[model samples]
Target: MAKPGSSGDEQLPSNEERGCEGIRSRLPLTTLELFFVSVIFGMFSITLLCIYITMPSVDQKFLKIPRTVEELRTLTEYVSKYTDSYKPQVLAGFCVTYIFMQTFMIPGTIVMSLLAGSLFGIAEGAALVIFTATAGASSCYFLSKLIGRPLAMWLWPDKLRFFTREVAKRRDYLFNYMLFLRVTPTLPNTFINVCSPIVGVPYLTFLVATMLGLLPATFVTVRAGVALNTLRSFNELYDVKTVGALFVIGFVSIMPAIMSKFQSQDSDRSHSS
Candidate 1:
């Protein structure tokens, strides 16, 4: 046995210490990465500024990010008036805003989806939401590829590990696994957007999964937007039935992976026999 003060008795670094060390080791690269992120933010800001400058004059009071049902209704009323006259401008602004929110992992996209439905009706709104959401998710995936490692490690170490392990186990069926994640509440979309690249999910897989898997949920929200005036609360958006439907969709998405796993198990058992 080692003596109490011997080097052999020294404990290995705890997870927290190791994490800090890893972060410190990447400090220089992290600084450069963050500079790039800031540059991207600046470019988006300028684009939004240009869109705003070109947009037709409207009451500034109605020009706010709707955080509540009442706010959404009010903005919907005012923006609808301008949408018809300035459809292209309105669409551009909406897409830019939605994409910016997603790329930065900002919240309130549900509100944006509702607004889309309110302005564009169900079919167009769903399509718009899907396109912008996919674009945003894609943007985030690439951004994460640049600087996501330390941030993911810092913000969600345990979740990152779990995601990485799951991803490794389902490499053969990665598309299905990713689709399931997008369809279900198993992981938050924002989290998925930020950590997907960090966990080694490919851009093509991420893009397709996001576009298709988000359809069901996006449709629900957009449909609700058409009747935004009637919504008493956000809780009404994802009631039990809706949540169950989403889960069913999620299960369907993963069915292929599940079948493959069972088939492999049976094959192994047969070989053993």
Candidate 2:
């Protein structure tokens, strides 16, 4: 039994509060809409479009990073001989191309990683791959944010839903999940990129997760790169030894998560009792 005045008071909002709520709802729609429109109309979008148009004109197939041990061996020799000549530009082009493919969710990142190793050798290849991949993933994050969720949904429907749900439910342990994804080699790199932003994964988390998450697989592929000519099939990359190691790594990566879940259940039971 409340007084009439109390009922009236509860229903009323202060002038400032009502105004703020109105601004909030409209801002995401109005302001964000304009932001996306700007990107679509602006120089960046135009340049990207132009790049896409001109891209097909280039020798894109030849542009692929090499894969195979013998290819790497020969590439290293060539680089060694021409270190003063073709090193910087070649590496720069490699980085740019790799980043472009990844940012756009192009399907050849695996070959790119192998190419780095095949062309640059283990240490240098891994470094280049990691750097370019991180940059590309970051670019995707911005692109997704700029375009908004609808475009992301169109680009990656199933992944967007799965990632969004996983992130919402296990936000605190997101790093754990990211680690699992990275180690298991389940999803491709581009799938993770296009879908991550739609889920609202924080930029710092995405950056750190991607940077760390991509390393082992990159290394594995890069190592395979050092043997490209010797290998006939991509399957040779994970012939038994590598797969076994990957599983062990995956297990180690997720053990902490299992421990955390168990601890939470124990705490809940204690509280109830």
Off by over 4 Å in 1: 1-29
Write down the lDDT of every candidate, Cα atoms only.
0.85, 0.65
lDDT of 1 by residue, 108-200 (tens): 999999999999999999999999999999998888888776676677667766776677767789999999999988899989998887666
For the record, the alpha-carbon RMSD of candidate 2 to the native fold, in angstroms, is 10.4
Please give each candidate's TM-score: 0.89, 0.70
Evaluated at residue 243, the lDDT of candidate 2 is: 72
Best by TM-score: 1
lDDT of 2 by residue, 1-273 (tens): 112223222322232235434434433334666666566446444554454454324343433345644544554555445334556656766676777776666666777777778777899989999999899888877776655454544444445555555666666677777777767766666667766665556677778878887787789989887777676766677768877787678778778988999999999999999
Give the per-residue Cα lDDT of candidate 1 at 32: 77
Q: Give the range where candidate 2 is weakest over 10 consecutive residues by summed lDDT.
A: 1-10
Candidate 1 lDDT score at position 98: 95
